[model samples]
Target: MYKASCSCRMLERKGILCRHIIWIYSSNGVKTIPDEYVVNRWCKDALRSKSFNCNGDPAEEIDIIDAKQISMSKMWSEVHQTVGIPMGRSKEVVDSFSSLIREFKEKLAPLGSQMSKEQEMVALIGCSTTQEVTIFPPKKSKNKGSGKRLLSSKTKAIALAMKPKRMYQNDN
Candidate 1:
């Protein structure tokens, strides 16, 4: 009988059993990993748990606005879990979702068509109107040639001063 032992770092790091421990259990005819080794966050229904407060306890007696927001969030989460994830996995599901979205947008178009003439005009004006401030090009300096000559003279002087004197070449 081969003895198997682990440093238990897997339990600390991953909240699960190490392969060494699993091997030992399998060799001893264990069928399933124990519940204590499983982390709730890794489970399928992890998000189905009750909402927790900042203090880490279950939240209670929220305001009406907060309750509505929470309900909307939960609905969105459920829809994403059920629809979005599956759609990503299957091309047929993705096509169906796309068609459903198109139909929904078409149905909603009439409801969104009640914009006032003033609102339409404002939107059109916003899109079409460009601010017409005259931007004068930068003024050309009157001393441009003098400035270039001064810069070139300074640079040439600096370069000549920095040039290393050739060794063994004495000034005659």
Candidate 2:
């Protein structure tokens, strides 16, 4: 224990402090290191430090796990056969999902076709008007007082250019 503490102190001086020095400081004794003290100190210290200098470099780069490539059938038949997961139920669920996808595609196909037709109709009736349909003036105004209220020629022209409001009485 004496030798270990000396070694830890030496490491601390050499700018190579390990968990052992923290362990020593935390326990503050020559005997056993308490787990809680070590954990608390390390956690608090870790938060302040920019990067962890401990455990230098990783051995090698490992490939990321892919669920798609991992054959569910193989996983069921051999690898995970011992587990309580019902393969039959899983298969049904997969099949059910496949059926749902198939149904969705079928429904979407008709909708797609209908949309294309509707798009064609919309193309036929685009925003641009085909024939120059001259807008005739309304024969008369329902409100007799509307004409009497004199407005500027510019205002009258703007009013004339705009689409006339239909005599639709409000229900309110």
Candidate 3:
């Protein structure tokens, strides 16, 4: 068994081999990554046995039954696989994929959620209140600065324009 290490210590910290170590292995005619370097935590089935709630009890597994949700989940998985291909190719390809994903998010934002912004936030944060909660507007807090009215940009611009301009008087 060939043993090698890199100064980066990527394998030590992240449980993944660094590029230098990969390069060394490739140059040494090592056709495949060693089984020892591959961490169990990164494996797809690693979390299968770790399904537990905060109280150390096994969490209830909810199976997806909704046709739309099932379809969407499958579609997302497909998209993820497709995107993974270009990730190792080039910077331009990755950037193009990023912009495409961003555009999709922007276009789908309104269609995804029917609730108001505040309600959407509450839903996203998983906040369930027993009583109906009324959210009032935030009260204005006094600043530490001495109470002086700050001049607005428009007012400052007007003040600047009203200032007397120095004209050259002909000196005989």
Candidate 4:
């Protein structure tokens, strides 16, 4: 004979009705939760309806690089839509996003090199001549201040003073 009211936060958070709601329904002689209460995203067959493969492509025929690029693009686009678009309105959000992208690019450089090595190996094995292989030399920055800046005179003097004394002298 007790009155119970659910906050419905479980429905909002987990996309499923809480036990309290279920109990209330059961006590009231309701056979099951209503169709409206069940979210499509929580359904087991939600992703199965989509024709996308593991690489997130609807098309069955696609190369590994193309598939990877397509999947990554889809992922980034989704992320941009969900998180970036709203947050991007603010300067702080834009700066944070730029930094995050810079760090991500730095981390992904090695993976890119690994993929290039894999492609080179595939080419060496003579799998397909249709696969175009182009090697470009690393481009040097034209900017004069591309790297570390020279230390100030005071800092250089301090560094020279901190240097360890040589134990042995070599005449040669």
Worst 10 residues of 3 by lDDT: 124-133
Regions more than 4 Å wrong, model 4: 1-5, 41-57, 61-172
Could you tell me which 10 consecutive residues in candidate 2 have the lowest summed lDDT? Answer: 49-58
Q: Which scores greater on lDDT, model 3 or model 4?
A: 3
> 6-55, model 1: which lDDT tens digit per residue?
78777777766788898888888978777766688888867664677443
Q: Where in model 3 is the C-alpha error above 4 Å?
A: 48-58, 63-68, 71-128, 131-172
When 1 and 2 are scored with TM-score, the better candidate is 1
Tens-digit lDDT track for model 4 on 1-172? 3334478678778776789888888988888567778677877866545356433457553326667668989998987785546463788877777788789889888876555765795655534344455677889868767688879999999999999987997899
Residue 86 lDDT in candidate 3: 79
Scored by lDDT, model 4 comes in at 0.71
Candidate 1 — which residues are off by over 4 angstroms?
A: 1-5, 42-107, 113-172
- lDDT of candidate 3 over 118-137, digit per residue (tens): 68766655553336556878
Candidate 1 has a TM-score of 0.30
Q: What are the lDDT figures for the candidates, one per model? A: 0.71, 0.57, 0.81, 0.71
In candidate 4 the C-alpha lDDT for residue 131 amounts to 45
The CA lDDT at 67 in model 1 is: 77
Instruction: In candidate 4, list every pair of residues with a backbone clash.
Output: none
Best by TM-score: 3
The clash tally of candidate 1 reads 0
